[model samples]
Target: MKFSTAAIMAFPAALLLAWQAAAAPGQGPDAETRAWWTITEALSNDRMEGRDTGSAGYDRAAQLVADKFKAAGLKPLGDKGSWFQPVAMNEIAIERAGIGVGDRPLVFLQDITVDPSNAMPVTVDAPLAYRGYCGAAALGDVRGKIVICHGVNRPGLPGAAERIAAVKAAGGIGLATIADPGFAIEPPRWPFAYARSVTLANASPDTDGFLRLRLKADALKKAIGDHGPDAGDLIAKGSAGEPLPGFDIRESFHATFTVKRRQITSSNVIGLLPGSDPASTDQAIVLSAHLDGYGFGTPVNGDGLYNGTLDDAAYVALLIRVAEQRRGKGYRRPVIFAAFTGEEKGLLGSTWFVAHPTLPRTSIAANINLDQLRPIFPLDLLTVHALDDTSLGDDVRAVANGMNIAVQHDPEPARNLLRRSDQWPFLQAGIPATAFVFGYRPGTESERIYRQWYRTGYHTPLDDPHQHIDWKAAADFNRFFKTLVERVADQEAAPAWKAGSSLRPAGH
Candidate 1:
């Protein structure tokens, strides 16, 4: 069959429209559902290239989000009458990496993972010291030496990052940490060559070190060779919450790394829906979701695009649906919809937004952010992050109860999800904030589905829109989200921090 260029170009949209129409009798999902589907399909399309921050694909996704905001009657709340608030960053990629001891070459991505931010050809040949959990006393004689450390031994112990900083301050030349069992290296998601690292240009350090890498446990053990406790023994003790005494390991590690750095700009897409009530219009509610995902990288299953269908594309779609549904409506306070960029790169966009807010900083009342909430199963339970930290938890419970859905606190605190998403920036700025994840009790079918999704697709190219999702569950959450926003916006006063709440930053 022969087809014209126009016909080929029109196929996807026409097919999607047909699917929408076929789902109903000559009418499709109401405007809200159609709105959600259209935005999700457009953003997740292969052509968008997974919306990696600072890439052309990310620019296209940002534009799409801005257009949706404009079409939904949202007031542009970005810089100088623009929908884009520019964020400056530096992108770093590893060009060369190798580690060796004596004449033995330790494999990359197997025996070790290097810090790509290290200056090219970072030749480090230094003495080695084993600093267990890096207490102030443990950091002795770190000058000009490579420091090996156990990962966190308990929740309150100094973590790997903290230990690295201390070692660097004490003049350590290199840092390597044993993989924390769940670190990115052991199961190796992408190949070693696919390094796409980014850091904020404003926060760039004046000096760089052979920062840190994940050293394979067995490989480290072989290197120590009875000079110190075995790597596996240290890890087992750390994993079991036991502390170990610091000692010197009799070995010197050598490594060289090459990296390429480039300055780039990405943006956060912000829009505002002004409230109807004169009294409350001064304060606003913010809804946020990230628009960036891992772009093209080392191919997995011969696919390199990390199309974040659920990781964020879905929730960004939800934000659009809510904005479209609430246009010209009667909420008492304004609502700000922010599609953040560089979330995968340490919540850069939201951090920048909070630091340089378009609105008066104190006037922003609360933030309800969304990241990846897999709706693969029914929507019977919702897990609210930082639920006990502020009054926003009460609001979530009230809204979920009205919808007949049970609300729960973060069930897995060890994941430290509370401090991981875009919402954390708002909370840090002393604004009441929280985020949601679909909840599942242990050993249930819902738990099974959630775990399987995480194990298989969480950050991979496999998270594309072609994967399974319960559309009805999405619609249900959309309804619940809309009601929550409306109620919070219409409340008599701005959401408040509970007295004595640990999250209430000093003088907030």
Candidate 2:
């Protein structure tokens, strides 16, 4: 049909609209993040692309935190007693990584790639010995040889002190897993690729060479056995076992890598509650929580943004409430409230803050750290990390007893979650700290009404206020912490780290 000038203009607009619709799913504003996000609205919006350490977004976030501290009436820890405490850091990303078996070049990610959890860069020219699994037996001197291990072995193998004799005897340089190598074969017969994950937690290779691989255990077993014990070896020594011919490494090779590392500056936003007593003000109790998240690429349904609402946003809000409550009550000792950044990046903000404090770091008494506190109900039990070594434990027991709440150690120690939050900074700096979280796992007896609300909304973009949270439960926890902090702040006694802890840093 012949169209008029008006119709012609509409066509371009219509095409543009269609293009937008087509790209909607994969490309759009991060809706889920926008929903669950509770970061400072100003900062999260202005720097929503993510506050990457080196990006302008980070600066915006810095300002928001500083403003919060200022509004809260806390003294600044910056150079001239300002709010910021700077830290140095360096960020790096992997450019290229490959493996080699003799002259065959191993493919990337699918075939073999180093795990960054416990990442290191290096070059090697040596034969490989598949140690089967990197259990305790895989230890020892693996000075110049490649030692093959399963992904599970990198964490300490049970009884590892004795088991790694083989690695020690052979002088191996590193140990790794080759479970599923870089790619896969489909019916059409082309290979597809997938990357591997690694961590320093389980990566216990004695030598410096660090890497991870994807492989089928039983299949690799047959191939290595058939080709001699060196069949699937990436570094080329003879791997023993039946060589499974159809199983292909596709690619495996190694080259020298120049690792660049650096430390960049970061900060912590803090406010305070001046005590009624001058002496007591010097000895303070810390109230803190991490103020950071996955930043981006965080899964919020289809949105790649991490809205850390219950992840600690709620805790931040609670902290504000507690501060408001204490402001009404006239504290006897200083109450230091810190909203720390760099928690997702490795607890750098708190670490730096404790190193350079606003008041006498030595006088600082204890820390009450709030995290992932989307309470579904008044928790019947309370969780504590590092509770064994300090007077804070006594305080917790007393307070929990008073509230009739069972005080328990971290139920999920496997996650190492106790040491995983912002509190670890204060703990490492000689302050006793406690972090609180609540949830009922699959098939549990918790009939608490808030359980259902917590189930679906914990970490997603849906964790907005609408996600059924027991505000009453949140209130109870707030009251519990407020009472706990009030008692500590009023007490003249100092809260200290348990003796024998490797964590107590000097001058803390």
Candidate 3:
């Protein structure tokens, strides 16, 4: 698969000037700095366990945020007349299970992590065929075949599934996604899965004829090779050629898991900054960031909370700041400041929010989502993803150009960061949305910083509120954000998608 290099365009000199620019009339986020830190600290405190959506801990966090909004004198746009916008949700936490090739069992949690997806009558005698990542073309056929692919494949092979897909396109079916899945989200890689069943699955889906391979190390290495720089560092994937040893048990490889499905409740904390104009109040610009994190993974500083400090904890703070700014401005359009939950569980929070919207969907002009941000990135430039087909992309570009920061589109399409964040729900609803993430690696030092973050901090209990932030960078970003919103909000017309653009709202 071809990869798009991340576009890192520099800002015009004027953008740099804005950092030190005179307040153009009114050019600063309201002086709610204390409020910013309080919200950030509270939601990310060790007690919350990373605020896993639907958890009691997250409920407490939500109540606190709503209280803060109420204290700020903001109103709820929700139907029920309260600032708290309840986002209905279904939460599933797969207990544990066992999978084995023979009498010898494959490691669980270590060598594999399976999603108790669905139940199949414990059948005996399954066949063999290992599919590739890209599917068929590079891998081979695997229909009614027991396939063995890597958890993470590497070099000299297109990856069994990629080959399998190629073959599938040429006519192939019944595939499985295997990879050495990890549980950390520090530097934030892929989610750990015994099998990558679907691009995105809803609730308890089928799991018969489908299986994710979590193989034994010896077999794994032969299948995937050492995961070194030479492995899949730059290109290729986990999957290689290995004939299935004519090994078959008269009965099927029986696997049992204590999978329980439960309906969980989480929320989207929404507060409205109603605009001065009643006509526009019905429509609004939404600011969103997920508030959930992988709670209870590794311990951080003796604290057990998966406090999503930077993942979205920071963005949540930013959302409040924006709300404060809009309320103060006596703005002309309703601005929805939403804190989403269940992002770690597949954008569930945002999905729930959109599906059970407090306001009409058509009135939602656009969404500005903040997933993760760091101080090191040059604050002078504004980086956004999913720029294609939206006028907002141009609005951002124009503002970036006017501000002098070069705008950029995502270089990596395969990653599909667009569909991955909270922005997708609105995007799917036909309203245009975009997200901002802080990412740029100039050299080894930067790489080291991100690496250490992933290994030692991300998704761990260690992700705490104690770490100091680059206050200046935070201020600068909020400044740019202020400008971006002012530009969008002040416009006499709502931002539109370019014709034939994939992002255009339905019936546009």
* Best lDDT among the predictions, by candidate number: 1
For candidate 2, what is the lDDT? Answer: 0.53
TM-score per model over all chains: 0.83, 0.65, 0.75
Candidate 2 Cα outliers beyond 4 Å, as residue runs? 1-55, 95-119, 122-129, 136-148, 151-156, 159-170, 177-263, 298-302, 325-330, 372-378, 439-472, 496-508
Instruction: Give one digit per residue, the lDDT tens place, for model 1 in 34-134.
Output: 67877898898898999988989989989999998998899899999999999999888766677776566777765777656635245777777777677
Where does candidate 1 have its weakest 10-residue lDDT segment? Answer: 184-193
lDDT at 211 for candidate 3?
40
Alpha-carbon lDDT, every model: 0.77, 0.53, 0.58
If ranked by TM-score, best first, what sequence of candidates would result? 1, 3, 2
Query: Compared with the true structure, what per-residue lDDT tens digits does model 2 show for residues 312-335?
Result: 555655565565444435578777
Flag regions of model 1 displaced more than 4 Å.
1-35, 109-111, 116-121, 127-143, 152-158, 165-171, 182-197, 204-210, 216-252
Clashes of 3: 54
**Number of the top-ranking candidate, with TM-score as the measure:** 1
Error of 2 at 247 (Å): 14
